[model samples]
Target chain A: MRRRTPAESPSKLSDVARLAGVSLSTVSNVLNHPTRVAASTRTRVEAAISELGFTPNRNARALVVGTTDSIGLVVFDLKNSLFVDIARGAQRRARGRGYSLQVGSSDSDVEQQAEHLRFFDAAQVSGLILAPMHDAPESVDRLRSHGRPVVIVNHDPAEANVCRVLVDNEQAGFLAVRHLIECGARRLGIVAGRRDLQPVELRVEGAHRAARESAVPVEVVEYPVDGLEPEYGDRMGSRLAALDRDERPDAVLAVTDMLAMTIISRLTAQGIRVPDDIRVMGCDHNTAAWGGAIPLSSVSLRGEALGEHAVDLLLDEIDDPAGHVHETITIGPSLHIRESTVGRPTATPPA
Target chain B: MRRRTPAESPSKLSDVARLAGVSLSTVSNVLNHPTRVAASTRTRVEAAISELGFTPNRNARALVVGTTDSIGLVVFDLKNSLFVDIARGAQRRARGRGYSLQVGSSDSDVEQQAEHLRFFDAAQVSGLILAPMHDAPESVDRLRSHGRPVVIVNHDPAEANVCRVLVDNEQAGFLAVRHLIECGARRLGIVAGRRDLQPVELRVEGAHRAARESAVPVEVVEYPVDGLEPEYGDRMGSRLAALDRDERPDAVLAVTDMLAMTIISRLTAQGIRVPDDIRVMGCDHNTAAWGGAIPLSSVSLRGEALGEHAVDLLLDEIDDPAGHVHETITIGPSLHIRESTVGRPTATPPA
Candidate 1:
């Protein structure tokens, strides 16, 4: 775990050149193209490099070799703790292999994503691990044409030529809805910010499939939101509270932990007993799912695991760029049951 | 919002040399030192540059100049959402100024922090925004000596020459304990990972100061943990719960929101009623504060604003390195009261 890089005062090529009594380019040639340098000059430069503990700047070395010991990652947003978790995992793995991670956030825009891609490409990074924004199939192609190894995270390009690590969104939806059904909730609701998203559509499909298999007919309703932020949870809570007693579903599932927890908070503030009057669940068991005012039952996306796997795949591609075969790794999500969807009575206050 | 970088096919200097019908070194000389190139050759190279839209690679340019259009940030940990919030704010400010943010987490290790510093130094970042690990005074000195502007975030270096953005930890601690005392809880317990750490010591000192001001006798018990993680919260929760009923503190304050929420979850699982049997609070008002099962009362560190201010300071230094005066910017913390410290009775279920 202890990685000691070279001394604080890095020995430069100029210092090596001074010690070897040669031009700076002679020292550079000794490192980059030793055969081009005179044997005596190369020997003198090598002795000086050892004496001074000189390490060439990776970027300068990369300029000659076309690659650096750095991995580039572009996520949708750093503010989202889920992406942070992924980045943390990626950093750990990248460091274990002696490579540093260079990160950029696209902020969920295709143009920004393309800009980031261009930067990484121009930087000549050894490899790229991207969580694409807006399904940029063309951008991926552009990245490939630049000749860097690529591993797309979370999204499935559904193409054989790209490597990706993905979660089974459809299975996650089925487990969540089926759990509610088994808990005696015949009416269920799903809240999604973007109904058109592929993951959202898959989750909805999974929920519908679960409803179809149930012995008792389950009525599934979908609630749409203008955005995917926590405030929408408050909006949904207010709208649901305003509904007729029988019109509101007894159980609700939110696409993310942030939205689910806020909805629970808003509903609890209105004096509704969670898992009693209405059960609530969420996906992406982020910090909110396990830590909220009412612990939310949720489907886990295993973001850290996704990130680690993506790095492994990207490194494999980097090692043998020409020999690399694109492959997809799909990880299944798990359900975490908590007080929000299960009845847990409060203890009597200490007398 | 749509900031476009130059074309993906970046024009190279070789292309300019080919167009100008000049040697590569002639074009290089024309760009780096126009006096070295013949007047006719320089004119041809300038015309070729205009026609080819060739801009020198940033890394190559950074070698001549001591900086690049990239801002480097080093944080303690990314999993701690507070840092993520700070990064989000820094990214926003840096983006507005046409600088790209390059982030690295030190994982709370001084060595890792130094490694990141070296990477940024070798990469020749325009400026550095650092949340130092273990309060290394020399690290900041080393960074500044390298000619890049350094803005220390979170921890105040106490040295006037070192720019910093800090949170008033002592004030935050006093607010949390005073709030508990105002709620009629005299006996208090504070769970901290390390009492020796500056932030932790300040918070504990704040609690003591608040106790001195309160009308009632406040017997504050300090509980130390191995680390500031959720597992430590569980450890503290079980130990507190094991204490004799009459000896237990009336209220508890955890060092972080994550720890506070976990303790609440553990205590609730053991049938203890929060804010009824014992009021609970936390600090750093991170995501766990709002999303936890009990909706913890916490002191907000305003991480985003801290990050924004850090970037502003760094950018100012980057813009006018010699003219810049290092000053500390302290932002006061605010308290957020929620259900963890305030009881809310649920409404009766519909008949």
Candidate 2:
């Protein structure tokens, strides 16, 4: 293959037409209205396109079409594999539907989130999928008013007019606590982060409900942290380890898998057995949970499903703006029991 | 704030000029060349822009300026938090330079990577930063031939004409094995993925160098796996467990932190104590290694630094393509010793 010089411009439609010995309109028909062109002519045009490496300018097409064949996904944080999984899922689905997915991480900053939203708006993307840090109804409304479809992922906004995809976080919490109770835990400690966050609040709510409904007299205690970092988990673990045997909770459920993994590591390092002393579990069933020393028991958040569904909803609205009716889709969570909660059964090695 | 209807188009320069009681040229100058406009006129134009919610169309601007105020970053996989960290670093740096960074994950598919490269080309972004799965010099050359600044990250291509930022995989391998040897290991087992991969091949080369350089005669064994999944790690662990006590290596070095974590988990499940019986270490000190049941000792790939340097090189080229010189910058890896390689000192709990 001969390398083209920097001074040489990219092959244009005219270049393709000239190479294929076809008129300009014929080349255009071959690209856009392919059915209108004869098979032989279309093949010739395609061969010419491949030979010349002619790539139609998406920006130029977007100007004509009023929207780009691109979807923007704004995630709160990319550090968590959950968001990464979501992006992977969204990207696959977007590609399958002949669109490119571009992602931006806001890093949990509200200002950064606004900047990303604005950038996508300026880009005039066909749609957006947002995993918001906070319920920014105004931002959603502003984007929607500009005729861009928006789908909120992993969040349920209070506004009824917006489309959203949410995991049943309450159900996730309920499952985690209920599983702990079933594992013979009478006292429970819920390691939670900021209560103001909707997911955290909802999970805590469901945990309390589980405690209230338990047949056994369970003492439910809450261990709050400023954030969900490993250091915070280490602190919680130290505080729990310091308690008298009778005062310590029989089991602990951390809000996230990372936190749970850290707490379990801390406990084990301090001479405390995992399931033997205090059972441990986490939420989000993250990829890291599977490879931990004690395989983590967690509630599955289904990040991939959330991402797929959000894109589905956004595309549906983009295809028919006026006729589209806003809807909120809720996905249910499930439990993944592992050695952290239940001692490893003597059997085949994990696959 | 009044809600604008979908029928309303985004505010244009004409609208801003009209509202600000300024000429169209003044409005254009205020946006394109702010210093060309008087302070009072600029303030009026800015206020009009704020009030009318004017977002300059990036696509239109790109057509005029030949590039958008955006940079494209294509990573091999989003599933790896290392890539995510790189994206985060690139984004922060790009944002500081008044540009938005858009990321696309190729998911380790060659076709997907080509598609992303094409997408960015059509988008006509200011520059591109890619962490390629395979060294495709032709693709890089083609992109560069179009006058687009390309900075390859985490991979060193054989071609010296392109700019690249790379972590020294050979050094990473040497660091892991040297640490294991320092901790009193006469025999070493390298758990690696496919040898076709450049990083794997380079790491193995460094591991051999370390073994050869050892003062005492050291035996080295290679345990090759099909892939880096946890299942592969588990299989490797089981195979090593079944080996005769004298046949098994005194220490093991996995190619990746993820693989090492899984191996440790599997070994511990089968009653093999890390460090006490066989020391274990890994290359690429990933974030998950910190919270594992046994804290993993590995080599730091410095993903963030790689990303930051890639962007710096890209932006420098984009700013002055003719004046820029292509350079391959190598980043050396450092060892991070933890409990997996050496028994923890009994002082204080992990923070």
Candidate 3:
């Protein structure tokens, strides 16, 4: 029984004006900005607006007076706490401005990322904050075509042309490796995330650079498995321990705290003493790393500051579309040393 | 410098119908159900809609027929993986039934929950799926007054008036303890979540019941710091190790798998050998627990099933109000013994 009673008709502005006993301009002023209208007339117009249930038509009105009180955020891997922290920061900033966020995750899939872009396009979001993976340059171009403001995160192009917020990964990696070296570690192993990822590349590059500069010939090995996490760390730790004493690396560096914790757990379980025998270090000083079984020694990638800056960049882009400048803002990679990387540096053999 | 424009001469259905070269009924059908209309006719009607930007007056329309397309989900902790999994399940199922879910987190704050309720009220969502922390039965009663549907998750008092989804916490607790006892664990510890929470209470009760039934006296220690997480587990583990050897429990059963992993990590780093010195167990076999880490023995709670059932309950309440029943569906807490709980039943107690 799908029957159509005539679609409900909204009260005309004329009706509202007539009911308010005012000129049409006065009614318009009241709807647009009541503060500009006289108090007595404003009261009448308000009464009429309440009576009519008029939430001024956004499409028609926005064209004349461009404003939509919404913000959009596109992220990679909503499951990741890093992204969640960024989203939380963005949400706080957005809410402070009396705006709400439309959040969507790409789940690390390019297709999914594009789909979210399309949805936000149709939604006509006022601003977009994206943390694109792998193919960011191509996605940036598509985002520009939508005629909406966009700010990128976790990416800083070697030759930049976009607003970005990120941590200094190369420095973070150097700090992590240098810490192990300072603690008397020489034979080193690093469990890096997908090598193709910029953070991993930068960190590894920095670690090797540090090795080249240092007198001790640091034998650095890439412990590559499927992902950057504890599970793979466990596997790597077990294999590393199986090596006869001299063959095993003196220390290991994990690209992420998650990997660091995993390696520590596995190595400890296998009767390999931490710091006393082998040192462990990592980047990303997330609370979970501190909160978990072993408080990991890590280079704190100040995610909150990055997040706050990302929001600031988005708001800047939103305020002035023709601002004519795009750049990446990098925050801290302060080192936090804990039980994992404690002992002094040891002699290392050349790789 | 905003000026009043004569509200574009009232365009009626007749004007749109004539312009689209379609009958009024055709336009009505296109608006109500585009699927029922021919593609060409639907395109024509859409063109007309764009030309006029005709918005059916919602206020007048509401007076005649009340319905909104959105569904609402109220959860206490959206940041939690357990809740996130449940949210994803709910969103997928709701979207399948042609409804979009508007999600809000209570943050375990009653005030925040009420504020979100107000937003949902304004949005006029068709149904609600609540993971409520406070007195929600009263809130549910208030929401029902608006003729909207509500379903509670993991709550009690499941009557024909409401629908709920819960995990068998008692069974989960019982199985975990039973497995430890079967493994010849002479002393046991239950590391649970927030003590005030209903789920925690039920799980602890189950553990108590199992210990009693087994005729083995078990010592239970409750740690109510923040929530059930890795950090809390680590704190608990470290504290347990610090206790007198005779007073310390042989095995620990974490309320959740994340807690279990944390406990494992903490004890290992502290030079305490798991299984040999202190066995550990946890509930909820999440991917994080299973991936790459030790194969943890856990009580698997059917989160996905609960999600699927929540949707069914919501849709039923929405489709046929009279036929809708408020009831709770309890799912499994099957025990899975892993390396953590290694001792067989009848093992001698340590002195």
lDDT, each prediction: 0.75, 0.78, 0.66
**Residue A321 lDDT in candidate 3:** 64
- Top-DockQ candidate index: 1
- Best-first order by TM-score: 1, 2, 3
- What is the Å distance of residue A232 in model 3 from its true position? 6.6
Assess each model's interface with DockQ, reporting 2 decimals per model: 0.24, 0.14, 0.04
Worst 10 residues of 2 chain A by lDDT: A57-66
Instruction: Provide i-RMS per model in Å.
Output: 4.1, 5.6, 10.9
- Candidate 3 chain B lowest-lDDT run of ten: B342-351
Q: Write the per-residue lDDT of candidate 1 for residues B1-351, one digit (tens) a residue.
A: 122254344455556766898754455457545885688889899999888766543444333443337788898888777887788888776665556777788887776677677767776778889887557778777877888888888886667777788889999999999999999887899888866567877888888888888888888888888888789998888888888878989999888887888888778777777878789999887774455556678898888778777776676567556655566777789988877888654443443
List chain B TM-scores, each candidate: 0.77, 0.78, 0.70
lDDT of 3 by residue, B1-351 (tens): 122233433344444666898754455456544686799889888888678765432233333433225566767655555565666667656554545454555556775566556556555668788888744766788888988788887666434567777888889888888888877767778887687777777878887787888866666665544787667877976887687888878877887777887777767666666677777887766535542123467776665556656766676567557644344566675666666666322221222
Instruction: Please report how far candidate 2 places residue A186 from its true position, in Å.
Output: 2.5
* Isolated chain A TM-score, each model: 0.76, 0.78, 0.72
What proportion of the true contacts does each candidate reproduce?
Answer: 0.47, 0.23, 0.00
